[model samples]
Target: MRISTSQFYETSSANYQRNFSNVVKTGQQASDNIRVRTAADDPVGAARLLQLQQQSNLIDQYDGNITNVRNSLGTSESTLNGITNILARVKELTISAGSGGYTDADRKADAQELTQLEEQLYSLMNSRDENGKYLFSGSRGDTPPYVRNADGTYTYQGDQSTLSLQVGDMLTMASNESGYSVFEQALNTSRSQTKLTSPLVDDGRVSLSNGQVSGSTQYNDRFRGGEPYTITFTSSTQFKITDAANNDVTLEATGEGKFDPSKPGGVTFRGVEMALDINLSDADKPNADALIAGHTFSLGSKPDEVSGSRSPGNTSSSQITGASISDSTAYNNAFPGGGAVIKFTSASAYEVYAQPMGPDARPVATGTLTGTPATKAKIAGVDFDFSAPPAAGDQFSVKVDNHQTQNILDTISEFRKALELPVDKDLASRQKYQGALQSAIGNLESGANKVAEAISSIGARGAALDVQADTNESLKMANTKTQSSIRDADPAEVLTRLSLQQTMLQASQLAFTKISSLSLFNRL
Candidate 1:
């Protein structure tokens, strides 16, 4: 191992430099705490930390999203609560107005109050979020969900779409309820009385059912879709049905439960399920004491469909005339129905009335229509043969009043109007509303229940958001801990290694100084 002085010095210098570099690197690691500041320190650990960092950022974003969801859902819940409270108050007012002792003046005062309440309801339905977006407007957040029509009635202008937000990796939640579901699609219905009565008497009663649009095989369409119809008793033993407008519907035997006069207690008129219980009455046949001779007749003999056209001379054919039949009423007995229509009984008058049985009838709802309805007015799901004019609250349509629900709003609104019945109109008008108020109450309750359910759904979503937030937070903490384990260096271990490197560097320098001195001067 003989070496020149220059070679010895160069080798010693290289050794010293190597030990000094180790000392610097280890000292830096001890000072910094982390094992890998860059890929050069620990390539695999740095790559893994990068992935974890990205995950942690995503978790933070999800948490932010959860916060927004809570805010939006909380707003929805609060708004729905307000609406429910309003409905409750309306229910209270309706009950108070139904009192028999309430005078006309008193009822008028109630109506004024109700008008204010209706306006309040309108405002509540058109609620907006803090950001000025319509809450119930669904995906169309910028547009107003409800609009007051010219008739003073409200209409839903928003589409039926929900707004959803991503709250977690696999979780998404709906943040808004569509106006249709919250306001327009409430679970209310106008069902025909569970039991119906079909009388053979002139003033006899008959119940009508809301016919299906499908015109199902069980019960087919018997009358026109948009036309008003009448079933009149020509005698104590016979009755016939006539269409007041275009004949778009007809009776067919194809359905399972079509009008079968021959069947016992199973009779229908124009697809309307009729309850027939033939009964004999003392008046059926007057004794000889009262008339020339004793005449006895059966109470019910299902009369065949009257086939004929409108003519002054013919009575067998179905006839629709301006002639008002006995006991004509504004209330249609057959129900369980859609469509909200107002009909003018008199030719183009502002006065509106309901004619379920005949032409002459007392108006059930008395208010101002913005004008005449664009189409025929519907009451209890059947068209009212709309006549133009007379100002009232307004003639409006509720498609939610579809066949399943009938025109429940018409029934309820009419019941409300009846609260302020006029003395001049038929006293029977109040009687009709008085009888129907109970059923209308049931419908209102149903609507309220639907709103409650929707509110509950929103609350549930809020709860889910909380759960996702907690889950993301836990996941984020775990990711941080794992990243720490992979990238963080032990302080004691780093310190020890740094000290050893410094010692090595010091020893290398002293050895190099001694060896270089011997090779040049001491060697001589």
Candidate 2:
């Protein structure tokens, strides 16, 4: 076939252009460290590279988020640790206060120190993050979690829900615990009580153990609570009881132990049970008989306001000796109104009288309470066993209740109260202080456990974040390597390809020149 020189030159020129373009592309790939500069270079590889880049960017973003989680979790762990330490210190202080050796002044000083500890605990509970967000406020990050009430009580103002952060594609972790759970709920120490008081034990022959409400299921079912009973022994063998409504209780020896102030026996009259100590000394006989007088002992549904000599119900053994459903429910029913106050008019009597109730409240049920070594006065469900010589005018009281604060606050308050109490405090006062202090100590251990649990969860969340971060790092490294293999050209391979392409281009140009010059003239 006869080929024209022009056609040959055209073909050779096209070859040279192709070679030159290949060399330029290889050199660019080597210099730029990329294999596909545009989609046209490698369509499939370009799409894959795009996907890998997105994955890499996502991994990097997660790493950043994980770093933030770590910071928050670390801060939470440290803060909880601080709280636990405060609890430990408070526990130690409580033990010292209950020793019963120190005077009221020593306890007051300890209470002052406890006040500082409470402040520290409050500060920790209300701690904020570096960004000024309350750590324990749950999702309500902008608001403070705890607020001090007007009554000097601390209240939780934050929601109970926790905050969480996304740590992985399908994983989310709780970043914080609610303030209510960590502080308020866990440390709740408020309780219901039916405390009692004992008469003066100045007469050694008449030693009185603190009195308590054993139980009167019938009394609980028949009468409203918070009512005090007035037991007036008409004689050594007989007595009469009255209620807040002035209802009369007939004292018939229905139980084995009868209400005989002259001997030991149990008397059950109108669902109330009391043990009578007939073993009274000669001095106690008149005093025990004097219990026949009206308003000998008063029982308030509320706790007593017993302060140093300046308080009500502070004379003689005017202290809570026993606590039960203080013979009535008329007390708990008196909410939003003044608390019930049950005071004893005389130390010689085991009878309690209901104080005047609000106009709106129902009259409290009153019944006779006689105590004996054989059958003790049952308050609530517990029994009271004691032997004491009574003197007329020896008084005691039973107050309803107070909402004591959490472990730290209630404990500190009780300790302070004990310390400030006079050494001449009635036997009931001493027992009450000791019981409250001991209860506070028990509550502290549980509070510490809650703090520890919170710290543990924080640790677990931190570990999870660390694992997610590590996984992301691994994926990032793999993504980079795969991305390089798909999009980048090796320098050595690129250089070699560029050299071959240049050589081919030069050879094509030389051939084109030779062919163009040959023609029919050179052949002739």
Candidate 3:
């Protein structure tokens, strides 16, 4: 084969250049320790490395989220501990104030101290996290959870929504508790709003007093949901108790619903006790005792809905709005038998009847239109405003609701008011004070129990966060190992390949020089 001198030099030069390029590439791989520098190095391995890298980043982000959740839960738990301590102190002060020897001035001093503790509780309940967000404000981290009202009571401003953070690939954690759950929705077991049914004809001879929940567990089981429980006197010496569905509940306690008013004790049923005083000596045997026999007393019913509607026969532009229960006891008394109707005697004068609107029934309450459109009106204990005045004979009817919960702050505020009041030695004053004190103590205990429950929940969340953090650490370690294996170069293999390529390049250079010099001119 005949070859030109230029062709021979070109082939030799190409061989040396190829060997040198291999040495430089292998050296780069050895220095960097990366096997796949680009897609061309190893297409499938490079794609796998990208996926592993994304997973590693995700794990890092989850670790950060776990830290944030732990901080939030820790702050919340610390704040709740402070609240628990304050509530304990308040309970101690309250119990001490109940001593009969403690004068009004002494009680007032206790109230002043309680006020300070309550303020502290308020501050703690509105705690903030390291990020300057309110801890108990639920989803409304920027807003205060509790606000003091003009009446010196605290109102919950936050909602029931929880703020949750993603802590793992498939797990999310609630970073905060709603104030409503932690403090506002505590149960008031001592609530016993008692009233006589409207059907009882009275000459002010019968009085019910000391109405309270004597057994918390039984009372809660029976009356917590505002279920209507009624006591009806089958006779002057006996009464039958029935539930909302009118099923005889007294039968469960005693086979026969029997009571002797002549006995020293009052009527007791299902953890509730109330003193029923009847002037038996003054009783008009056939008439007064007969009224007592048919009389019904409803206990512990709550206001669920307060609304009004205009009568279809009404010829006026009158409409009622903002109807609500101002006093639950009065509302229950007003509608023990049924609903109430507002009948206009004139453009400005109105009468309220406890029964449905009818000509024969007498009015139970009366009110005068004060505004041009008669803006303000109240019936029994329900308050409502009117948009316009009704013409003569126009009527409106109000309905009752049976659902409500007293918040923790309201319970504390009520106790504060009772402590601040000065009670005389009179029987009525002393009895009233005793009742208020008893109710306040029961409610405070309920609030304390609720706070404890919240603390326990926070602790559980903290434990869960700890577990997630450890899991994330394990996952991070595993992911790092996987990434290194898929994308990193073996140091020994790269260095050996680089050495071999360098030696080959040197041999190619020496051979090319020898051959190039020995062309036809040099050989001749």
Q: All candidates' lDDT scores?
A: 0.55, 0.58, 0.74
Worst 10 residues of 1 by lDDT: 300-309
* Residue 328, model 3, lDDT: 72
Candidate 2 global lDDT: 0.58
Put down candidate 2 lDDT per residue, 1-524, tens digits, no spaces.
Answer: 98876787678878988988898888788778788878898999999988988888777777777887888888888998888888888888888876747777777777788888888887888899999999988888887776653335444546668877776777877777787576554432323232222233222222112122223354445533525654544544555556677766443325321344545455444343333333455666676645432223333223422111112324443333334444345334532122232322344334333322223544332222465422234433223332343334432323332432243444455555555665535654655565466456655765677778788888888878878888887888899889988888878888888888889888988887777777567778
Model 2 TM-score? 0.59
How are the candidates ranked when ordered by lDDT, highest leading? 3, 2, 1
Best by lDDT: 3
Best-fitting candidate, scored by TM-score: 3
Give per-residue lDDT, candidate 3, residue 416.
85
- lDDT by residue (tens digit), candidate 1, 194-278: 2222332323223222321222232223333423444433332344444556342333313322332333443343333433423
Candidate 3: where are CA atoms >4 Å away? 196-249, 252-268, 271-297, 304-383, 386-404
**Which whole-number lDDT from 0 to 100 does residue 280 have in model 2?**
53
Give each model's clash number: 19, 63, 5
